[model samples]
Target: MSTLSFLLLFLSTFAFIAGGSAAKSWALSDNNWGLLVLTLALYSAGNLIMLRLVRDLGMGVALSLSGFVQLLAVNVVAFFIFGESIAPLHAAGLVLGIVAVALMTYPV
Candidate 1:
């Protein structure tokens, strides 16, 4: 993958992860419409960037790669930022998921 594509995808995924965090905050708060709005806006921006990603890389590759990025990033954020933990068995499954994504996204 091109470095540009990787950077753009990372930016898009960061927006999505921020949106997810905003949504979680909204859920924890009481009637915080601002957080909800922010979530929607971030998601919209991420999707907008995704259009470019899909155009540069095909649909399958773009989404598959993005999914892989999201899988790793979201978990890291959830674990460290949100103080979440996964069971040992599930951690093994996460490793498997990483391998699966690596296989899917490997150069053909």
Candidate 2:
């Protein structure tokens, strides 16, 4: 990937992570119906950004890298911000996910 495309992908990934973090906050609201709407809006923006990045970079690289970035972001947020714990199984799953991304994104 070109440097500019890589930078865009990185920024898109960060936006996705930020949007997802904001989305998770909606779960705490008592009026749960609005939560779904708000979360969708946030996620949609993230997806749009991701789509643009993918267009610039190509699907295999964009998606695989984004997937790993997002997974790590979610895990960190879940553990630190949300006070959630990852069991051994969850950690194993994360490792597997990372491996899959690596394999898929590797140059042929």
Candidate 3:
């Protein structure tokens, strides 16, 4: 993928991550309407950027890379921001997900 594509993907990924954070906050704060709106807006913007990415990098490759990156990022948000813990099994699963991404994205 091109550098531009990478940058776009990262932006969209962060958007999605922020949306997730907003969603969690919304739930925690008794379903705040503003946070819910922010969550939807972030996810929508992320998807729009992702649609551009599909043009730049093929859907399969783009989503595979994006999904893997999101998986790792969400874990970080879950841990540090949410004060969550990771078990050994979950770590193993994350490693396996990394392997799956590598296999999925390798040049044909």
Clashing pairs counted in every model: 0, 0, 0
**Model 1 quality (TM-score):** 0.91
Q: Compared to the true structure, candidate 3 yields what TM-score?
A: 0.91
Arrange candidates by lDDT, highest first: which order? 1, 3, 2
lDDT of each: 0.93, 0.76, 0.93
Question: What's the TM-score of each model vs. the native?
Answer: 0.91, 0.80, 0.91
Local accuracy of candidate 3 as per-residue lDDT tens digits, 30-108: 8789999999999999999999999988899899989989988998999999998989998999899988987898888
User: What CA root-mean-square deviation does each model show from the true structure?
Assistant: 1.3, 2.2, 1.3
* Model 1 per-residue lDDT tens digits across residues 57-104: 999999989989999999998899988899999999999999999899
Error of 1 at 64 (Å): 1.0
Off by over 4 Å in 3: none
Clashing pairs in 2: none
| Candidates 1 and 2 compared by lDDT, better number | 1
